[model samples]
Target: MVLRVNGLFGWVRANDRRSIALFGGLILAINVGAALFLLLPLLAVDPDHAPVTAWGGYARRYVPLVTLAAGAVFALHLMRHVRSVQRLTGFAFVDDADEPRLCRLVEPLAIGMGLPAPYVGVIEARALNAFACGLGRRDAVVVVTRGLIDALDDEELAAVLAHELAHIVNGDIRLLAAADAGLRLVGWLARPPAARRQQVGALLSLPVIMAVLPPLFVFILIAGICGQAAIRGSRLIRLMISSSREFIADACAVEATQNPAALVSALRRIDGRSRLNHLPPGQDAMMIDGASEGGFATHPTIARRIAVIVAVTGSMALNAPKRRDTRSPDQRDRAACAIRTGVFGAAPPASERGTPDLVDPGDARNWLGFTPVMTLGAVLAVAVFLGMHRHDLHRPAALAAALDPRPAGILLAVVGREFVCNAAFSSVGLALRATGLDRPVGCDAAPARDLAAAQTSGSVGRFLAALTEPPAGLSMHPNGTFGSAPSPATEAETVRTRRCFRTKGYARGDGGLHAVDAPPRRDGAFDIGRWLAGAEAQAVQTAAAGPEAGDRPLDDYLSSRKSIVHAVDRYFGEPGLAMMRRSFASPSHQRAIGRLRERLGDPRWAAGLPPVRRAEFTLLANSPEDFVTCSARDRMDRKATVPPT
Candidate 1:
């Protein structure tokens, strides 16, 4: 337990350090930029301001002083009323006398985390959720809903409390509150009605804010409304900070409790329940759960988090079956049903329902490492690209001077196509050649125009065909009107002369990239407005899980993970998955993958593979030099077919 706790703590610290380092660097850069912004405006205020030519000296003297002064003031007021927001939203302070057990639970945990006890608050929410916030451990507040208190068992409750306490000890609670407030204010001011009026007010008040408060507050305000990108960027950064924070906090909780099972149990129970809470944007992050599987998400998926916990603990950690809930059984059942529908939505036809776990998916992951495309397609792409667009590349002034005569857009589009295609092909070729493996890479879908093109042409072929051909009009292609395939392959069955790899999700029986006419499940009865609405909310209805259904609702939901493509993207994003794939590509990777695939039986391959996956990642990490580039003579000299470039 001690060793597990220490390891989990170390993981927590590492993720915290990485995420915080990035957040800190961004904050420092923004502050420095803010100081420079204030300089010119401040100079204008000076009665005897330095002339434009001699302003360097003035800036050097004034910038640092103003920056420091403003930052100090902003730090104080930024998170001042954070707790009040929750209180005003109807959370009541918990009296120790009234809730001795809850207070008692927090005290020991706070002591373990080396922090003063946090204030506890309770919301009347029926949803099971809780979060922590404060300037630091000393004044931290852990807020829970009445439902959460009622729902979680003692161990689960302790786990939840420990998690929130972990947030306080981490010193992220306060920073999160400040950032959320800053970002929310920006979003509010960016809307049209607040446009010039808000801008004028902020600018006019800058002098007073700089003089009395911290210039940091002014900086944050300015950065918030800098532009749409700035506002969005801030929100994204904040969300990332929040996302990584949850993982660290979970680890910290495990360490504090020395029980990963409790946390996992709590997470699973709370996962779908929290959706019904009327949480504010900022508060949603602090909660046990919300929309955890999207781009602008606050937390990683509940299953992923649980898997991570299992990885950290090296234990099954699946709680002994819970003494199921009794009161409001119908309500619980309905919540579960809604969650199943919302998270998984409807399954596509059996043909489209299952995507295999391949070494690579859809040639989308590493565009440059694919072997089949690179060796055969890259040289051709370069020739075609230059031949078709060399005139435009040579014409420097054409963009500004040419009055729509040169077909510049067409030329640029083709160049982009060539560049993208070759990059994909090159990546494939590099991976194969590096691994000393000569394999074919082509889609196995029936020969539709695009599928045919995909099979024979470079990665660009499929992409271009999807855009221009029938059914799957992925996007508008310039090739439809302007030019033809420079080296078109006949629309015939692309034979698998070489070894073709399967991506995990898209691996069909034939093992090809284009298994369908269109990209996954976006086929059949597509309605513009309803589709958009459903995109935001997967409100598909599901019949009650019964004997005939022969499926666990939760399992179905987990299997059909929300935002399928986004989920796939995450697997690609992980270093562990990449390492595992790279290892599978070369003999070492390939052999390791073979053993691994045999061990991991079919069905439910995507989920809960984290433990073994992490072990493989560990193996790779330990012997990194062995896998770095598959040294031609290091050990496999006898079998080195193609040297790694």
Candidate 2:
């Protein structure tokens, strides 16, 4: 236990140092840009200012001094707030049974090291992913995805879980969260809104400030660009930090479990199965897949990871386990039942519910590097283009005289530049919604059309879609035309009609357009409105309430929750059961069957019929668990596949 704790603590220290070093260069660069923002203002300030003359032109200047101070404060405030946000996001945990296993592992390790047990939670996702979150050891939570649980056997699962614990112990979670927060802060600062209002206010106070302000603004803009560049440089460093942490975690996990073979085999199988296509950026390092290059992604390559595990242990079992032949039964009834269900025709007994010794995380790996740089590069490229246009706006009169049709090049340039910046901002906005941080203003479903397009297509896709599509129709009433997907004209009308109140924010009388001043609603109210209504919520609640019947055991609950796809592919895939065949006629039909099939995995023992079906097969429940009551009307069949009344 002491050893585990020390190991984790040492890991955190090492990880932090590496991360700090990686991001150090970027921070310095950002400071340099920020420093310019401060220094230029001093130069702009009057030479006669007291500070200028006080020290014989040494330390007396004020504007630059003040600006520098202000910039620092701004940066610091942003850093602090963003850190909190990142930490909070990391702290979110899923409440489930797997959490106990994590606690068990961490507890022993913590006891060995004289540390407290860390909080553990499950993420309700199919993706094989996991991450540790907290500002520090005492504050952290380790979250693993359900897909990971379903994928890895025991030893492998333990390895991945241990790796995350190592991150918490080493302090990698806090460090990375801090770094991400800083980057996000800097990006937010560089946005036009943060500065635009200030610039306008400054102009209002002293119109002459505008005269030299453009140059000043230009300088600040360059500084902002440099700041972003620094951030990118910092991210590169953090990647290396993450890699080293992975190495240490692997070593620590082996030491803790004393089962290097499990870790090695886990890595081997996980390496082959991982995918990189759906990895969410910024959080890639936290995933078991570690990008795609094996571990070199966020950790290192699987080869490197495996080699380390092997070196730490001794020669592992080289022979692969014999593959089990597909089951063949003479009776058509058994085969048909298997086909009608999923891969797992029946739930494994409770004792066999989980692998006791697996050591891998999962197969989905992230090989691609962190992309903050790419995003920054794109933003800078657009800003530079826009700045050039601003220069054009200055010479619009000259260009007008040169060309017959007054050169709207300046107009085009300004619009184009602003468009890029706005698009980027909008993309960020959409991501916020997806992450459940905030909702878009004045949108019924938050119009997330741009967000949807981005997710389905790509960032560029989102930009193009937004560019081609007109502003969404505004609705004065909650259930107005804009509530549903409608014609372009209706969309246009909604936008036009609601344009007046769009400025008012989300109020009852007007459409629930969000107030800019308010933080995004956390209840996911906007999306909830779009998806679940009174009837929908009631229905879901009723179903989720569990078998209207009676008491159910743990095994029944676990099995019932398993995906029907697993059972259907296992049972119905065979050429026997007519009912199962009719159910799984199409992939879409198969998916529908899978959803319903999940409930059947549970054994409603309280109803007390026969033990064979209860022990060997799962029974459908009204909700998560029920022994007696079930919705006779198949909800999936009635609503999903069949027409509604």
Candidate 3:
């Protein structure tokens, strides 16, 4: 008979440490393999050549470049993941009002572990569960279900936060993310799909194969079969191996917080509640399941996790001293202050407030039916185009080769690019959605007005119509006029309330360009404030920037705009800021800027900047020879222009 509790508190700590060490060693091995795979090709090209003079030299020259590109892509993927997590977590009914109190409890524990305060979020589900997600500490998000919040008191909550912090500290997320991306690339590269029929003519050419001969045929066929099998096997193995990381994380959490009972209690509650709130499957490891052990389990069983935690801490609880607020004297004053400020007053009526649509048009459920058809249409369209314009098929192989830039790499690269790019575009569609409901019945785009009059159509029909038809008067040009500017009365009221930043309007024309008006602004010197302030200002604009900004009440506009702008700014700020910054940079800065200039294509801005020159320079001391080779310090004086790619 096994002593379950004893096993829980015993052996887990040691096992977890060992697992972590193993993981680090495995990662090192992976890096070594990557290095070798990259180097072997160059070696095979010309072994007789000097190692430095040969492919090794080229590899060395481009390793940094490759690393930078890969790193940037990974960073972008992680950022996207965080945003997705935030949105899904925010949507759940968890009350954020208690976040400060929750933070207060978790902060001490975080400090005890030398970690930054973990972001705490609440979901409005009755599941006693929590998960920590982010690529790293600075970007992490902690989401706790409503049930978890309701079930666990302060101490337990701290314990849960500590456990998640352990995951962060161990860099579990980073490791898992790397593993996932690597496997995906490997899978993509291994099972390269064939191009369409027209594009496959070259592969079918008898003479082309005759030139390459039986060796090429034998190699390609064998590699294709074996490579696909290996990739599939690797994926399954990766999934299996990854589950152990969860157990290791549980142990790490115990070490970080030095509390076992709290975690155990939280687990008991979560298990009992049995309320399921699944995040995207890709993010399952970040959830509370420590050892998703079964069908879709990404972690081990709770019992095993508890055992691990118990083994490490040995029944000791590392409880920190709680803050005691003994401010009896200030109670009456606080009550009086609240009354004076009207903070305790009755809630405002619904009509007085702004309301966002109950549904979002681009939500996965709303788009689910249409997306498949749209995607199939896109694929079929590409196939049809390739078939009809068979002459154009000549480029696919060359294009594939260029994209992959390696022999036989084209097939894999093209397939991956198509899938990834399409997914990215789908995400973009989701990001741009404004409303969920369909246009009202009889609400067709009136040709002259470009506006659809609201009627009583079902939400789905209106949504479809909105996508299929352009509004009547809306010009798809980005620079199209936004009618007249707001009147003085509207401007004064908006400015007084400081809601100008988001009140601008935009209409898309047939060309798919959005013609937007000048967005409202604060009295600040710069365009937009920091993210939070910008969000507030934008919401104010969205509420007020409707049919008659010139006539709408500033109060009503402020209320309405607040909700819309908050989401818009949260999602769109970085790109928006880059756009705005490009619009107003000094001439010298503009000259130095490479990609920014090309993207903005503002002729005036480009013309204003001084021309950059490329020069070869040599350094010499006083009375020294003019042709002396420059040392690193001498080269510092020279400014080399980076050519825009």
Candidate 4:
């Protein structure tokens, strides 16, 4: 027995060291990964943007600082979580005055183990469970549910107290507390951005949406990936910390009490009844019997624990457990249905029975009892919203100016610049400054130049001109309207004009002119409202002109609207541009476009067009509303086709 005990002690020592190392390594990896994630976008954009020395310096300065900060935060969070657990479990520290029997049971066990008597507490729960928690020996606490005390005999109760005392003596309490804290910290950090959904939805202004969404989405994606990794890593660490400690504690309990039979009996009584349904998840590691059972279970099964105890102690009682409850059905049902009424005449409602009143009255859920932490989160959210909207807030005049189309366009351009060029440079600059590598770069001037060019260029006017002008192969009729097909001479001119337009950056699908002089603003900056308004006006005018004018007026207006839609597409770098080009090159699209032009030129050619030609023409003749609706539908269709980052 002595040899077996010594071997278990040795194993415990080695496993403890391994658990600590794994936990520290996981934290270090997380800190390093965070730093790298921050720098990833910059590196992806321009690999040679920063020097090797700069990166090395960044690691040397910030990695340690970040690790230290993380440690400090974890420590604070762990302490707070410990207190929260105590509160949530409705356990209060007791003395000889509050519970003479419980204190008397634990004090002797502590003395026998050559450890200070840890504080004793009682949970109001009727569940048969117990757990030990603390930072260290001095502040350690052992808590038992009332159900446990009432269910077990004096010997069995002493064995359970001895088991908890073993945890304190072996320093398992501290490790368990740390594991609990880590699991919660990772979960809270990695939680999806549901709180910000309302804020994002409230951003009705186009400029605000444009300015905020890119960075916000980037943050969410990176946080989501890192959060999942952290959560998994924390769980693995908790499992490692907990897996062996329970066995060692169980073994120690038998050794301390010198009565393996008592523990075996206690285990048998407690096995299925130990799970506390009111207690939150992730507390399984600390409980006498885990609240859950799975492959990833923190505690060894009760049967496995009994077998080990028997092997080490050679206790015949453990191997001979064939006892069964002999109570009558009525008596058993009454015992099972018993509820603690405290000092009251009858038990409160089921929902209000077990848990204690939370420190915060506003906290309706026991799980979210950390009111101060929630307040801090709310403050952080407000700060982020304010930071993102600083541009709009500081320049209220710009928002009012947006009512005018030209200012609105310019304001959009500015926001786009901030989103794309300025934000990138700012992030890089902050990183460089942190690393003491803040040297002036030529790239600093690029955004300013782009903003200036956008402000000066008559791109909107050129866009409108491109939309209103008729495409080649169409001729003017005697009524001063364009609705006639070209002559043979004009057909050759038409092909030449089409070839020239294609070379000048016109998409064949809609004959929309792309701005070649100015670089395409990939940051969605177009004035959508202005375009929609123009389309609506054109639709009204076409309606007033009536069917007497044939489809000539309708065709002209639709074609113009399509041109503007494609121009916006071009501005946003035309997602799926390659697919669009391939489609336009197909023989089917060619025939469809030819038939569409004929139908536009002669309203009476056919009362209705074929589905293929109609669909193709619809693509080229949609108003702003139709364009938006189609774009949304197409995006949904192509959602699966988009590659994962």
Candidate 5:
């Protein structure tokens, strides 16, 4: 048993060094990658530039300067609140004066371990958990939740305190603190751009909107990708710290206390209740029992820890406390209040506690969060500069054109315009429909001769016209005929119906009566309306062309026809109607659409059309099937009778 424990201790020490080295390497790699990304433009412009050549010289003059600056910033930030356990957990430090019993238990354990009597704090949470955190012995603090204190007997509590003291002695606190610092640094780097300053008036300034949006999107995209990488790196560092340290600490606690049974009993008591929800991800390693159990878990399962302890101690039966401490409410409050005031009398003198090397308040806020406007402006300036000097660099003309700021800006503007215009059209149409103002027009009878003439045009042509030409509020009749009607007042509603019709199986040709295909329903139930509609269309087709006209099977024909309905029943029956409504109701979409309309070169494109007509055109233009439905075959077939304006 002694041999095994000694072997484990040696293994843990070596692993700890490797973990630290791995973390240092991760930081170096990240810094190097960032430096390269920032200097890419310079390197691309002239690899032989004097400053670049000198920086890349054998001695590497600039590397140390960059390293020093980064290290200094990191160290300063970490030290600013080194003793912040109380601040983070909202637990006040307790000394012997506050709770002599609790402090007495911890003090003897610290003395036995040959370490300073660290600060002891108690959380008000009901979860049974305890953790030790600090840079080293002098500043170390042990925090236990109220639940843990009330659950365990004196022997069990002493064993738990010994385990935490072992962490301080083993320097595990410093290692965990470094991992936490790395995580915080990554979070600081990846934070989103601050909100833009608002204008005084009700209306927003167009110039400001245009200037902010593209850069905002670019920053988000770039920062999101980089942030993910940093997060993964931090996770890797924690994994490197390994769960072996937990075993080592457990072994040391048993050695110091010489009571393996008490430690095992403490483990049993804390088995399922040691998780602290308020603690962040990387800090789980500091807990006696981590928040989770898996391959990635920072601590071994409670059962495994106990088994190992029993095996090492060669003990079979263990005695543990069954009942919790039954202290009254007044007693608990007195204990809490005593701890809260203990620090005031016991705190070190100002002169003895050296000034913290904290980052400047103004610089910390501005730099860590990132000044979006200024940062974006600088990026744009660099891009513009590179574009202008691309030809002189003797690079490919294509590369220079790609780098040109004008094309990028124009592309973003055009996309933003289209998005905004579509949103506006959808929003206004929905508002009109919701208020019962824009009602759909009733079907008006059209000449049978006109319907025949329209059908005579190529099927492909009819299909294209239905898609490309704006919705004319045309209705399909029961008698296999068409009727012209006034454009619906609720254009979005009508457009949505038409869209649903196409999606269900109605094809553009054959006066929108033929069903090309029927999509399978998720519920696996046959649609009766679709089936009936298919039978009616099939009968009409059979009558027009004799029984043996087409060789297609009857089942296939019926299946296709099953989805083509003449009424708005098909639209209302759709499952995605509510989702569609919510999407159109989105304010961002509306704002984008408005911006798009304002940026268009030709006012007549949208402004000349009535609101309803404008919405119909916008809906058609933005439909996913527009390209395929409005094909050249349909556009060129001009013989089809057009709907009356």
Candidate 6:
């Protein structure tokens, strides 16, 4: 019962067939009405005075152009959308030989879903989430983060794979794109036309704000933001529909994998840990819904997703086996307990203090193969980057390439190479770095991936807090969210303080220290973004002078020399390491390095890690907050990723 392309396409087309029949009937009705109106006038007046055929000529001439325009747009959507989105958001194919484990797990799930195995891509992020993209089942690609592979147990991973496959089978990829475009059109209709830019200089200046983007790019940016806000009374309803699709996808995952508990566990593990939300506009609609919201949210809370899963499976325990199993309770429990070490290579719970997951040097998913396959992929990506840069030069050529399926697929494969982070690959940068490819003149101030600025912060305060206290061009929300909400005249307004941060002890091997961000014991109220950003930004630069001098965090106060090096480290790792050793690179971090030195002293430090790496570790430690307790505001949030021990 494998899902053949023919069968899948037929079913999808059958289920999603548009109202072309109805449109044809409506067209006949409209013509009939027009003829009756014209003929009735002729009946009242002289036949020669009537203008019955006046409108027919104009309709005949113009209708073809309208149809042609609609066809052209549909062709563009089918041809360009898949690859453009893959490139726009960083995503690369997962090499089966290199990442055998992920490939191994996904194939069975694909079979379970009755579809041809899907192409898998890695997002090269430390965030524990995944999203699917395709024009159809044949072209489908499921993109998982490096974090998702690292954290989830085998069954949980399978559940996720099944969910992504479900999206493909249901034609959700094209449907989502179509729905989003329709919504945008609705928004456009709801608002007046955009005002034209006043001057050429004003138009040219936009790219500077968006990391040296072109004028056309700025237009796309403005449209994405403005369109979402313009929709009227039905806006909330659309969001509800979006949210419902997620539930359906979840159900599909469960039905495919028969492991609702694993999906629940997987959802819990994600918990909005990565700072992907901050990465530019136009991508939010496509990525996983990890942002905070109220009524108009696209995805429900993790709790709600889990509750649905539990209700369907009728299994209350996270570790329980399938509900239909006739096995005795003890045997089922025993099977659950064995989850610590399975195909996914998980370890027992921390309370049990089991041995760590074995790390194989040859494991393709890890950094061991970086010198060969990983480096090769990086080289190919750079070439594709160059090609895409070249491709952007001629509009018609680019459009032609997009319209041609083979060329577009090749472009996506090459573009997708930039996806993995520097960890597993030769490169070390994470997913949030914008390509900034094909930017116009006056390009400068490129965002560095090593800094984690774009990838980590969730709340606006959290994102801003990562920058200098007065973060450049960022807005702060009095409420925990961005937009405002109205209150009744007699209602008592809620008073609140800004949520900030304090520090926890250094977490060794993580290359950073921990912050005790939570308030009431796992109340799930702690904001990861504020904890990381605000707490770090709060740190006084002990090495600086004057009142404002020593206040910047280690990240903001980097010497001009290291700033370029940090920027370079966005793609290259070892050079940043070399730059760190030049001199007091990170004074704030030195304190931690000093702590490590004292703790590991000379003999053990030498034995544990090479002398050369000591400096790199100190420099990799980003940001430093002066431990302070300010007036509490509702804190920002992001990831809850606990690194593998």
Top of the candidates by TM-score: 4
What is the Cα-based lDDT of residue 148 in candidate 4? 74
Off by over 4 Å in 6: 1-68, 183-238, 286-288, 292-296, 316-645
Q: Which run of 10 residues does model 2 get worst, by summed lDDT?
A: 500-509
lDDT tens digits by residue: candidate 6, 441-495: 2122222221233222112213334432323443322111122222211111111
Models ranked on TM-score: 4, 5, 1, 2, 3, 6
lDDT winner:
4
True-structure RMSD, every candidate: 36.1, 34.0, 30.4, 25.2, 26.4, 35.0
4 or 6, greater by TM-score: 4
lDDT of 1 at 62: 57
lDDT of 1 by residue, 1-645 (tens): 123335555666666677677566445444443443443344333312322323565557655665575466457545554544454335667878967767878888889889877788876655677888667766778887766766666777889999988888878787676666555443333322212244345334333322222222323334334534444556577777787788788888888887778888889878767753333333466666666654346777898888777776665475443433333555446545545555321222334222321111011111222234222333443444445445666675532232221122222334444444445657697786777543323311122332233332322333435544534323222223223321112111111111111122332122222212233346533222232233223212112234554323323322232233222223222332243333224443234333334333434653443332333333333442332221211223444666667
Q: What is the TM-score of each candidate against the true structure?
A: 0.42, 0.39, 0.37, 0.49, 0.44, 0.36
Count: clashes, candidate 3: 35
User: Cα miss at 252, model 3 (Å)?
Assistant: 5.3
Model 4 agreement with the true structure over 220-302: per-residue lDDT tens digits: 34454565566556666776677678777877887887777888889987877776665545556787888335434567678
Worst 10-residue lDDT window, candidate 4? 360-369
CA deviation > 4 Å runs, candidate 5: 1-7, 29-62, 190-226, 293-297, 316-645
Candidate 2, after superposition: displacement of residue 524 in Å? 72
lDDT of 5 by residue, 216-291 (tens): 2344444445544554555566655646667778888888877778888888868776655554444566778873
What lDDT score belongs to each candidate, Candidate 1 first?
A: 0.49, 0.43, 0.43, 0.55, 0.52, 0.43
Give per-residue CA lDDT, model 2, range 1-645, as digits (tens): 123324333645665565666666545544443443334333323222322123344234444654476456545644453234333222234333535544555567655544467766654333455667666667666666544555555566676777777676666666665555445444443332223344334224222222212232333345545544554554465567767778777776666665666666667655634432223344466555566442224556778666655544446424334322222243234434433542221222334233222112121211211133333433454454345345455676532332221112222222333344445557788786676553234233322332333221222233434444445663322211233344434433433332210111121213333322244357754332222133233333333444653334333333332323223222222221222333334344333234445545443533353332332223332222221111212222346686666
